[model samples]
Target: MKRIAIDMDEVMADFTKKHLALFNADYNEAITLEDLQGKKLRDLRPHLVDEIREYLKDPTYFRDLDVMKDAQEVIKELSESFEIYIATAAMHFPSSFTAKYEWLQEHFPFLDDQHFVFCGDKSVIKADYLIDDNVYQLERFTGEGILFTAPHNIHEDRFIRVNSWANVRDYFLK
Candidate 1:
């Protein structure tokens, strides 16, 4: 079976709003990761680190993340023809990795421990295909990328530019 590595944030889960809300609650300001260079979680202001540290302490924060539209249906359909694995950049933080894994299990009961992989860099992960919203990650895994577009201005140009999971499904089916 073809091995497909999927990103959890944005692709399978709606993290943008929740992440912004978490940051706003912690910083008392409506700042987003886009306010930083690279527009990534790791590029946030140094002062935001403490807030992030505190926010991640709550297990419910990760557990409450909403799954993307049609995610369950898409994953179920894709899994029938591929060995699906949930690989996410959000899993890089050691403190929240375990909780994130637990949350994924609870949120996506169709996925098991063997179907998940927590990694900082996806370039090194072995996979026949990878679906991610981050342009940098898509560039890193270009040969196997199925880039998922997001509402971020920074990555608007770099992602493969698909609007929905149905597009992704069609790409692979063809």
Candidate 2:
């Protein structure tokens, strides 16, 4: 069976939504997804960039993120045919290790703990395919890279793109 490495944040988890909610609530700003099209949060609101970094460092930040729509269902279905792995870059934030692991356990209990990879670089992941929101990770991957569309990567066109979990199902399961 072919292995598929799936990204956690912005792909399997609703990182953008939670990040925006926290930032908007604290800064009294109304930054919508439309405002972030083709741009990162830090790029869109450079003034509040520091606060954004601080948010990722918080222990509850990754732990409290909601699962991406249809992600659990589609990924569960895909697991029947493809080898599924959750590949997350957790080293970026030392505090996120436990939070991310716990979040995965809570939201994706069907996945085996051994399949979870918490690392700094995604290029080291050995899989036949990689579904990630960041093009940088995909760029370095040795296998097929499918861009899981996020507000920041809406305009990126270098790799195949899947706008939703349903799209992901169609791409692989169909």
Candidate 3:
């Protein structure tokens, strides 16, 4: 079976939406998704870098994230045919490791601890496929890469794009 490395952030988890909500609440301002388009949170608001980092330290930051639409359904189906592993970048925030672990247990109970690979860089991961929202990670990956669309990566065109989990299912079907 082909091994597939999936990313947890924007690919399966609604990371951008959660970050936007956190940013708005911390600043007490109305910031629309358009405001964060094509840029990361820290890059969009450099002044709030400390605040963003502070939030990352919070236990609920990663644990309370909303799962992406259809992610569970598509992943569950994919796992039946492929060896699935969740390779997420969680080393930056010390609290993220445990929080993400707990989050996965709560949301994706089917995935066990052995299926997780939490690291600072994703280049070390080896698999037949890597589905991630970050182009940087894909650039370093030695396998076939599928770009899971996020607002920040909409303009990227180097890899195959899967805009939704339904699209992901279709892409893999081929």
RMSD of 3: 1.3
All candidates in order of TM-score, best leading: 2, 3, 1
Better by TM-score, candidate 3 or 2: 2
Could you tell me the lDDT of residue 84 within candidate 2?
96
Which wins on lDDT, candidate 2 or candidate 3?
2
Q: In candidate 3, what are the lDDT values of residues 18-86, reduced to their tens digit?
A: 777877886887777777677777887788788877877887788888999999998998988999999
Each prediction's whole-model lDDT (CA) = 0.74, 0.92, 0.87
Candidate 1 regions with alpha-carbon error over 4 angstroms: 24-54, 57-59, 153-159
What digit string (tens of lDDT, one per residue) describes model 2 on residues 1-174? Answer: 999999999999899998899889998999999999999989978887888899999888899888899999999999999999989988889889999999999999999999999987888999999999999899999999999989888878899999999999999988
lDDT of 1 by residue, 118-144 (tens): 888778778888888877787787357
TM-score of each model, paired residue for residue: 0.76, 0.98, 0.94
lDDT for residue 67 in candidate 2, whole number 0-100:
87
> Model 3, residue 117: what's the lDDT?
93
Lowest-lDDT window of 10 residues in candidate 3? 32-41
